[model samples]
Target: MSGLAALCFLLLQTGACGFEILGWFFRGKSLTHEDITERAILNTTVQVCRALALAEGKDFTFPPQPFTAESVAVACGASKSSKSFCKAISLIQRKNWNVDLFRFYSSRHHFDDETFIEGRKIITEGLSAVKASNKRENFEAAREKLGNILHPLQDFYSHSNWVEMGNNLPNPNLIRAGTSIGNIAGKYNVTVCLDEIEKRNA
Candidate 1:
């Protein structure tokens, strides 16, 4: 029995076993790794979607649109906006709170360096895709598109950063700017418009 216990401990430390035996010792229920990961994914996905919605000026309470696997793949394959949408969907799907995950991992003596690194990697990939798609045109078009959509507030175009200003400006006008951005995001069904704005700003 002692040898069995030792073997279980070793397996847990090595991440070789699905079940975590230490749960019994810690007065917690045992759970499989896949189960935990799936739950985490779902939680993360919901949160991310909510954040995206909020950024676009929409209420986060609306149910997430059903995202099929094919849709996920296609969106991921699309331009920078699509990639950003994909990442947001993926994170929302995970449904796990990042801070909680960090704490849980730390409690288990696991490092979360990869989590942060992977997030940055995804951002980089999305930026690259957007840039590659925009190479054919100058930045002016992108800024114009954003300005057109955000015209309700104001209209200013930034060529260097590709930002289109609506009536809401960002410094003396920062709050209004954020409000305009959120409202625009909420109004659009397709995420491509917002994605373009992000690409320009990037």
Candidate 2:
């Protein structure tokens, strides 16, 4: 009877230890949805602000006062601006908005890689469709469509494959593409392309 009692105690202790280790592993390695949202927003905001400042011939500064999504959207959507500048603002707004929504949904549910990849493809297709529409209406439609595509991304981040999805993204070249596209689109309205051109020249 004493031997059985000792064996039971050992099993309980081993189980407790295993649970503790598993807790530590998940705590150290996993990223919460909030973490992903904040990181994406912060990174995109900084990049967008820098691009805006350069376009406007102003010195680039961090944490520009009163920065908000609405403000950014308005700045980019200005009708009086060059098409390129407007496009940059539009792109930044869309990208960040998509990421924000993606994080929000991801926090609550599971999503798969095929979903995200398919969503991206849809966004690209939508962009193509809008290019031929009336400029203002086209961009607005594109923005709306982008919001739709981001819906699934939010839920996807909650899945076990979230990290793997991030890892599978196309890398920095896409970032460069975004930047270049913004500059070209905004060039007629602002001089954001100057720095990028100088870099290419050098």
Using Cα atoms with residue i matched to residue i, what is each candidate's TM-score against the true structure? 0.22, 0.35
lDDT of 1 at 196: 94
In candidate 2, the residue pairs with backbone N, CA or C atoms under 3 Å apart (3 or more residues apart, or in different chains) clash, namely: 82-189, 84-185, 84-186, 85-186, 102-154, 105-154, 105-155, 106-154, 106-155
Going through the candidates in order, what is the number of backbone clashes in each?
27, 9
Reference-based TM-score, model 1? 0.22
lDDT of 1 by residue, 1-202 (tens): 2221221122223222223423323444445332333333334444555566678887655333454333433433333355555454344323222323343444211213323223223323433343443575644443222222221111111111113223222322211222222232223345458879999999
RMSD values for the candidates in order, in angstroms, are 23.7, 24.2
Q: lDDT by residue for model 2 over 115-164, one digit each (tens)? A: 43444344345444444433556655644543343333333323333234
In candidate 1, which residue ranges exceed 4 Å CA deviation? Answer: 1-29, 62-202
lDDT for every model?
0.32, 0.38
CA lDDT for candidate 2: 0.38
Q: Residue 154 of model 2: what lDDT?
A: 36
